[model samples]
Target: MSTAVVPGIEEIARVQGRTVRVLAAGQVLGGVSFGATVSLGALLAADLSGEESLSGFATAAVTLGAALCAIPLARLAGVRGRRFALTLGNAFALAGIAIVILSAALRLFPLLLAGVILIGAGNAGNLQSRFAATDLATPRRRGRDLGTVVWATTVGGVLGPLMITPGEALGAVVGMPPLTGAYLFSIVAQVAALVLYLVALRPDPLALAQRIALSAGPSGPVVESDRPVAARYAMLAVAASHVVMASVMAMTPIHLSHIAHAAHGGHAVETTEITLLVGTTIALHVLGMYGASPLFGWLADRIGRVTTILAGLGILTLALGTLTLWPDEQPAVVVGLFLLGLGWSAGTVAGSALLTESTPIARRPRRQGLSDTTMTASAAVGSVLAGIVLGGPGYGALALIALAIVAVTALLSPLGRR
Candidate 1:
């Protein structure tokens, strides 16, 4: 018979508040690095490979790396706790950034891919931190807590792309390749995140939750019934949404550059204009992704996860439809991308909250890890195919394809009355 050692509700709430604050701070800094990398990774790949066709490889590598690392990190969290796993993930990102700098200096495409893969591992940690927020949360507040952490990323995500021109200038001052300078900023940002995680994430939320549950006796906390089915549905929804978002997002910069050049009568587009367009578009998209998460979370808790997911699909369809109608138009592209981010935000937050609610406490981390792995792996495949489609039938066709996928996801959703 296990003795009950449950902490008081007020104590639990206090710890939860502290945990979220620390996680949010780390996420902000981590977001800076990730946002900058997202803006530059594909461009750097195209430049290094000397083939626009391979542009997707960089994003794909990052997603694939995230996929590869997700399970291991989750297992580590399961065994050692969230702090250990998060710290290790940041370390991998730091090392990867270093290698990326070296690869850029030497103009080695393979090495660059290797380094990006490590950065992806770090992303796995960053992504998992949102879930960590839910470990000690009351069932009623799970979505809201998750949303707060996701929303925190907005600060860094918005600032990241705006740093590109300055990052290049910094590179020039340091006698480094322009494209490589972002990694320098990334290195510093990741180090700060790693240190924050190591020093501040106290009481180890997962371990604490586990102890509290065990203290409740052999019956444990009341877990949801039909968890397996709900878990499967949640995973599918999250993965499908991620595929749509990553496929289009991964190809956006390349598309923007091509159209800009064509509009200029086959001459290279001015760097300043390209930076302005891409940076502004990406900044807005990130805003859409993170800014509305709180509302979506509240909706998830109030309306239901399935309804939130269906709403996300509707928004995604609208986004894809807009892109299909106005393929190369900058304003339309910006609107579509922003909608895309918004839709993804809805699907991801709702689906993740549902997954957490549905799974058994002891098994939550593993299932969450599996969900992330599937999401990123599908995203990797979508990204690679996106490159092929964009290079062949063009952006209009790509939008049509994404729209079709959204339709299929809707049809397959488990939301209908059973």
Candidate 2:
């Protein structure tokens, strides 16, 4: 017997439109906090530890925290729905930001690390928001929907780093440490994000999608199994790309600072100059990361996920190559970083779409969580190693190491042959 049809196109579109709008708004606000943190994380670590080598530890802690929180958040999304999971994650981030301010005020390194990790947990939730956009999406438009949410981050991400100077000014006025200023802004933005999710994300997209699927009977999108191997490859693609991005990105500010100081003939870099350099470079990088996601998503749908992933690998290789060849050139470094963000966007968007399509509905959340866990964990390890390499052999060496990883990932990619 024939099964009942799923919801009509108009109904699905209505839900998808609302879901995307809410998710996009949340991403914009959340991106502000994330962008500020990324710009300041390693610098804060350097200040707290009094050692450049340990700077990566700050970002590493964040990634590790995200890794630890990934599964729990995913399970929460699975059981409680996306609104609950997203809000809870934001709450953790808000708390963590408060602790970060306290840690900075006290000069407590341990507390700083702990607080940053909690912030990372919030980041885990932000990452998952892209997937939430897909619950009500039609198969044909999944990539586009997911890419739109990813693209939404660009506004806040670019704006966040630019706030560094003003944040510092605000902190100084309030007797807070210089590095801690951006986090105050982070707190406000994250709170706004939390409130938005709590208020705007009504009807819980995942729950609604499941209901529609069930009502459609046996012919619905729900399936019993998926190819474990393909899912694993998709996870690997995302993880490897993230590792490259994180490792290089974690140390870039430090690298730039060092270059600036050296350029000034061993004089300390001017704070204004440092802020301008880091903020502009990171803004460009953020732009690369999210600006063209819609295009990449379109490519993923048209050219195929696997093929798009391979293209990401190629872009990454070029990025690493640029950095490796011209480690000291500011323009080249900017180009390299921009390419790095673009490559990450391509890999993550395409890999996520592939993984989602390949997995059964019932298993999707858990598997997606696992994928993010692995991705962040590996990135944490890479960040730690990046610190060591940057301290010893320098940025060029780090680039080379990341390049080797990308090569290995390409070889293992299911799309390599395709």
Candidate 3:
């Protein structure tokens, strides 16, 4: 079913304005819900298992669930439209939160895993929010629109940590633990998102897209209709960048700990201090990721997408090289992380905009879905691989791995040119 129908360009323009606002709201709420649960997975797992090794399992379960469902979920969005898929994903997330609450009450690990998995599937939906924004935008404004939605996410992500505090207080009142209460907050956020999307997103973007497709009357090789090798390369480069970012970020805590220990002459930094530093680093990185999106989008618009993409790779290369030079310095580590975030933002906006530009409307959803699924999977791989490499080859080695990926992304620039 269509969310809203437009008769022509004027109508489309009016609809587009409303659609962007609604989509941005959805992105923000989605980010909050995602952040609420994800930020504390380790603590929940530790409370359940009492062992650090098993705590990793919680994250693993979630990522595995998302990875498994990513491609299928994207295809589902393509066929069913983003509205239905997004709503269903929210439902899964709600159920997951409920399950976690129940599991925490009963002290059940398996149930926790189940809950986390569902949350991961919800994340699959969350990742596509940017792509959904692109659907209603014109070529000239595609990246900006996409970046705006992505930027909206920053609001919710920032609020998520605070959500847990209130959740904990409520849980204390209700006889549930603070952690269990956090899941309830997640449920509430997801439900609110569902309502906002259902009401505000209007008829549906995909349906509007179909109507636009029918109305356009054979425009110059509809962007979605054609798929060049360059498009595929763009997708690969985006995914690879995600992989490298995830892997390196995953091991940052360990790397930082090593630095602390060496600096202390074999005595590691206090756990609390390390945690605080890591938290700050991650927050800064996320800011860098979303904060610069608009600028990157603007850059992609002015320069060719390939040029922006290559610039991102060049930044990434420099960031990795810096890390390699001073793996133990906190300032350098922070700088590297910030640059990594900036590079990802640049590559993501440029590459995704290019992908949208290349494909026709009919194929856009599925292809975009494919791109997201691949990127998500790559992120999962990078997270796991970073742990392995950090344990064995060391943090410096992880920097080299990032450098290698940057090289590959740089090589793909030619594809975008063609």
Candidate 4:
């Protein structure tokens, strides 16, 4: 049997503050890592592969990598500790950055894809950090605490893309090829996160939480882990919300590009112009995604988790409704995408807090890992299916389809435990 050692209330409280700060710092750096690559990865793939069509695969590769890594890393946290798992994940990202730079220089497409995949895997760890924030939180304040960490993401996410210009200059100074320089920043950011995890994430929140739980008994406190309903609902809420967000967000750029092409009357527009439009719109979407997380998190705590989740669905419906009704309008699409990000933030933050409180401490790691895996996998599937749907019926139709998904999710919400 595992030894029953639990953290004292005062110790947990003290460490929780430190843990949040370190994790927040890690998120900022992590945002730099992911934000840079996600924007640049496809462009790099297109350049190296000499195939524009192949560019789409870059994001998919990252999504697949994150999905594949989520469960194993989560389980690692179960065995080793949050610090170990987080450090390993960021290290993988740092390594990926190196490989991406080398692959660009070598003109090796396969190698580039491999590197992108590893970056995705590293993202899986970044996703898990939200849950780590809740390991020792009181139920009354869980959503608020998790939201604060998530809110920290706004700083990094916004800064990541903007850093590209400077990152490029830095890379040029050091003789890096164009487009590859941004990843140099990625490397630095990821390494900083890795070091932060190593040095500051002391006492290992999950491990310490485990000890605190074990002190409750051999089975640990809160045997709800033995019950499937609450855990399953929490997981479903997060996964469903992610799928909707990913599916819609994935198609928005393609739809915008098509609009640009049509508006230009088949004249070839500069790729950079189209990219700028897409990038600016997406940046706003990301802002809505991370910037207001603290508000939603607070709402989740104050209004109740399931209520906030349902409210997220309402936002999704409004966003999708806008997209469906005004598919050809650029301004409407931009607004819709921003709203989509807001809805995702609310659902993910609230659902995560719910998952933490609902799951048993002894089984927390595996379940949390599994939830992330489910969330990422569903998103991958959603994004793929979205492309198909968008290609077949058109952008408006795609919004309608996603709206149906949100409806189904809302239908299921009634079955969830508060």
Candidate 5:
């Protein structure tokens, strides 16, 4: 009986490992798809109209979709469980990719936007992957697990732009025009992600969490969860960090375009170099976002989440200030962008850990969804505002605005103090 029990326990452990690996793979693939979509949007628009604004719109559409769906999707997962909720998200991605591919083939920009919206809905699901990791982890290792999943995203994200070259190559052989094949690649990635999620995420994490909660029969010296001041401050910090990150990151290509124009004596710039620069910066930004997540997550678990949050905001302050001073220098600009990515990763990991630890498990999903919604919504607003600001007040004013928001975050951090 003892021998049999030992084998059974080992099997269970093995199965759980498989489940986590599958979930990780799903997240990684999702990251690849998101990166591909972001990387390809400008190229797609350039093919269609050469209007920079259309690319911005395409990017914003995805954020809007995530902002709209974040809470609802979280609630759905909370009630139904991870398997069904994640599967639903993958389905949306699959369909969205299909629509995008079809739109590209047919040369329809509006339909492409709709497809992006659908993909954004899928992104909402992908963003929750960290939370899903938390649900399965022991409290002591929760941050590490969450960070590990995030780190996996960097792996696929780095590869996403490379996929575009292959996509274009395939397009050449298939005769689907220039950039239409990239969307087709997106469809394949999304579908593969869906399959990975279905096959690997076997025991639904939400359901497992519910079972664990039931067995633990909670009773502890829980902090008072009714502090509206702290919650609101936390929300603001999250939103501002996101806004700064998005505004600066999203506007990079526009900045590079201006640089190219200036180089050419104030005329419209060449295409290939601009594309390469944008692609490279985005990939670097993604690397910055995920590379240090594990370290930050571990820090949040030990040194207090609020302190980490403040530190992240301070990093953003430095990053934005650097950009303001050296707006025209490419190396400086790229380094500043990397700092923005690092700042965002720190804030997001710490903020999420704080929110999770502060709330009850039963209400975790709803609150998490709300936080994500606010973050994404603010980012959408920032992207649009960045375009306007870039055209008018330019990078100097934008960097100053980001600094002011960081100052606000610093002021609010005291609310979480005991």
Candidate 6:
């Protein structure tokens, strides 16, 4: 079970290096798989459900799935190690991918929702992989190592949305419904991730770290700091940031589609053309979400974690301002989405790093799992509410609602300081 006993710090560093690289590779594939979900999930769901308001349910379902799985996956990592938990998660995604294809072919909205929820469960692995990078890391380099893994998602994140054309072409060969073709590309990518986890993740990071902590005796290496920022603040920051981002991001595609519909005089717009616009915009957003993670991580380590988190909130507020001001402009939407991604990256990195350093080694996994669950569930609620808001007050209203959250989070963040 996840063994590769390290004799010393040097050996541990070597192993940590290997673990980061492997996890980075896995992240690349995970990012690719997620591209389809974010860019096309709402589109496909709306088309199948024939109810525009239900579009948010796509994002909600996936996030809820991840929320439900977060703690269980963490406990699994605690018991069986990350290798087993990550691989099992990937397996669920693979099956979900198959189900999505079948559901799309049959035009079954409920089945599609089920498939996507399972895919979200698989996403728990992607979320946790960054934390795994910190397992053997010394306190000094924890941010950098975690950010490196986060940055690796940039490549796949940018490319996954761009896969629409080729993915559709590949799917036409097999007669898949339009948006569902992107999931075809996802299948291959996720399979690669599954194999990578099974084959390369030797000396499981969490398990090995647990062993090392246990060797330090009962108290577990005293990871707690004398006046560390309240872990609750870090968790709250993460959850709040995620909610704003997910709410706005989840509604974007549908908003754009409405524009397309209006532009075409209420005539049906070609799905491909709509997806093209969505793919490009979402690609930029994904790029922002992951591209500067290293810088954010560095800032967290150098400039104080709370400061970095506040900066992220500021960016998020500005992003909402842009979207609320120009709700109908595609270029403006692109800029806003990109900013949203950047803000998410900053908050997620600084907040997660702070939470990690603040927590005890023995409690780290459970606490981190709780944070993920809170973050993911908050996002799920936002997305569901986003659909209702978008359906009622429209996109600008949605952005303004998100803006209010950024303001609230920024005001409360400093109080988390011990």
27, model 4: CA deviation in Å?
Answer: 0.4
Residue lDDT tens for model 1, 1-418: 2335766777888999999999999989988888887888888899888998899998898999999999999989988999999999999899888888888889999998999999899999999988999888877788888888999998888778777778877888989875776667787889999999999999888887777766744423324334777778888889988999989988998999987998899997777677667777888888888889889988988898889989999999999999999999988999999999999999999999889888877898899999999999999889999999999999889989989878987887774212
TM-score of model number 1: 0.96
User: Mind giving the per-residue lDDT tens digits that candidate 2 earns over 75-129?
Assistant: 8898888999999999989988888888887888888899989999999999999
Each prediction's TM-score versus the true structure:
0.96, 0.96, 0.86, 0.91, 0.88, 0.96
- Deviation in angstroms for 200 in model 6? 1.1
Query: Candidate 5, TM-score vs. the true structure?
Result: 0.88
Error of 5 at 60 (Å): 1.5
List CA RMSD, all candidates: 1.9, 2.5, 3.5, 2.8, 4.2, 2.2
List the global CA lDDT of all models: 0.87, 0.88, 0.73, 0.81, 0.74, 0.87
Q: By TM-score, highest first, what's the ranking?
A: 1, 2, 6, 4, 5, 3
Q: How accurate is candidate 1 locally (lDDT)?
A: 0.87
Q: How many angstroms is residue 6 displaced in model 4 relative to the true structure, after the best TM-score fit?
A: 4.6
> Could you tell me how far off, in angstroms, the CA of residue 333 lies in candidate 2 after the best superposition?
0.9
In candidate 1, stretches whose alpha carbon ends up further than 4 angstroms from where it belongs are: 1-4, 217-226, 415-418
Q: Report the lDDT tens digits of candidate 4 across residue range 83-144.
A: 98899899878778888898988989999889888988999999989988988777777888
Writing each residue's lDDT as its tens digit, candidate 5 over 220-274 gives 2122244445666666777778888877776676777777778789987655566
lDDT of 2: 0.88
Q: Write the per-residue lDDT of candidate 6 for residues 338-374, one digit (tens) a residue.
A: 9999999999998888888888766888888999999
* Regions of model 3 farther than 4 Å from truth: 1-6, 36-38, 42-60, 100-111, 161-185, 216-225, 254-275
Q: Give the Cα error of residue 81 in candidate 6, in Å.
A: 1.3
Angstrom error of the Cα, residue 292, model 6: value is 0.6
In model 3, the Cα lDDT at residue 84 comes to: 75
| Poorly placed runs, candidate 6 (over 4 Å) | 1-6, 216-229
Say which candidate scores most in lDDT: 2
Give the poorly placed runs of model 2, Cα more than 4 Å off: 1-8, 216-225, 415-418
What TM-score does candidate 3 get on C-alpha atoms? 0.86
